[model samples]
Target: MKTDDAERPNMAVSIGRLMLKNPVITASGTFGYGEEFAPYLDLGRLGGMVLKGISEKPRPGNPPPRIAETPSGLLNAIGLENVGVDAFVTEKAPFLETLDTTVIANIFGESADEYARVAGKLTDVKCVDALEVNISCPNVNRGGMDFGADPEQAAEVTRAVKEATDLPVIVKLTPNVTDITAVARRVEAAGADALSLINTIRGMSVDVYTARPRLANVTGGLSGPAIRPVAVLMVWETVQAVSIPVIGMGGIMNARDALEFLIAGARAVEVGTANFVNPAAVLDIIDGIERHLGDAGVDDINDIIGTLDCRRK
Candidate 1:
């Protein structure tokens, strides 16, 4: 039997300085600016919403056929299409201010200085709760994946952004690396308040008949159910490597998947590709987590985080 709404377990969790009512957050890019999904569900019910990646200036993104479907995942080369930071503060921030959920601004830049500049602009925005530095965008020509791949460069970027803003800075890490823990430790040393991992792995698809790439960019970030296991492992490893909170994401499609990340040691989980398949997936995940807690007689969601038994026989 399921517990009633009043009897459900407490789902609140914290990410660095930002406190969430629950642990389910909508990953950046997938949820747009939050206005698009307003009609489908109640935005206030969510733990948090990470808007699309924003740059100091507007980007048109890649050409047509920016997205392609895979067996159990998606390849996207949409770039970081956004209206720029100035417009976001003036136009988008107002609408986000009206919402009850925490609004985290995801910012990216081509250079370390540029990252600071963009973070500086967001500091005055009362609506923005925190800043999620997107240094893992594989589709961009420069600055995205490169900063995330090297420990020195990753620390430089994180330091620049932290120096520019008072908001909690969460560094989003890329999995397309030899050791993700190396990068996570670097960012943590640079004063990052939190970390969100396994940002899409680099992948590609080709049309067998045409002998051409499926995505316009030739390669794109791979997301969806295909990356869950990898994400779980990365999250587990990263949690052991750093003291800051880790927000795990990358192929989370249901409550079970979200629970896996939390159990592996993620303080919170983000729903990325799952949003495209079902707009209400985040809500379902939250409900499922509540039920899991109640059935197990768990009083708090934090009790299960990083509770994996590692005792060797």
Candidate 2:
């Protein structure tokens, strides 16, 4: 099942200095270290594989009942559980180096210093092509507000990460704020090489008869089909506000859904909740995008990026 090179569309995409084979990357926290999905699909087929978020120290994560389901959406309260940076460097780095795809490390912490340390730790790892800063975590020094919720905090963290590593830095944005573009601009100004946005929206589910929350954590990030529209909207608004390559995510479940983000202005789209439903989701999206391009007479994937016609008819 292969299309000849001359007949096939070019799917290559660039995010800063890192070049991906395609633009269908697996979202961080959704795809686990890339090694886990190797048996399910060809990991090399993906443009990039973003590992689960790693922290300054290992976290037990929220206790069980960490997941809940709803109509067309899923909720998770995993609490950013990870093997910690040092352990990840030893346990995960070797396996990651073997993969043919671009490997991106998603990192987060309670404070800017922690983020800096984590980025510093991975700078020497040859397997990690870039550092993706997950700014959705709380700023421990500043009460409990999210680093991404405030322009200054977000940029500060971004600056910290950029200063710590020579690797390209891609700051992942959260949708919990009033104006996402404001944060996007700040991060870019702070020296982020690229950006990925519309992380899961804060949401919850409740049990009827039990008169209690469905998850042990009570509240979790909502993802899946339900958030695609909101994610696309933010991606569109953000692309208009910033010059860096913006990768879009949140609730992307299929090739058609993936295309929505691409058409709306995202340079790439990350498959999140869909991975849980289908381990081969990334492969499917790549194939679907190729087919779509062939059918539309498009020769290169980048030709269609940010081509949305928003003018009112």
Report RMSD (Å) for each prediction in the order shown: 1.4, 1.7
Model 1, 44-133: lDDT tens digits are 999999999999999999997999998799999998999999989888888888999998999999999999999999999988999999
| Deviation (Å) of 182 in candidate 1 | 0.6
Point out the worst 10-residue segment of candidate 1 by lDDT: 1-10
Query: Candidate 1 lDDT (Cα, whole model)?
Result: 0.94
Off by over 4 Å in 1: 1-6
Best TM-score among the predictions, by candidate number? 1
Candidate 2 per-residue lDDT over residues 76-162, each given as its tens digit: 878888899999999999999988989899998888999999999999988999988988743123312378889999999999999
Candidate 2 collision pairs: 224-251
Q: Candidate 2 at 97: error in angstroms?
A: 0.8
Q: What is the lDDT of every predicted structure here?
A: 0.94, 0.88
Clashing pairs in 1: none
**Cα TM-score per model:** 0.97, 0.97
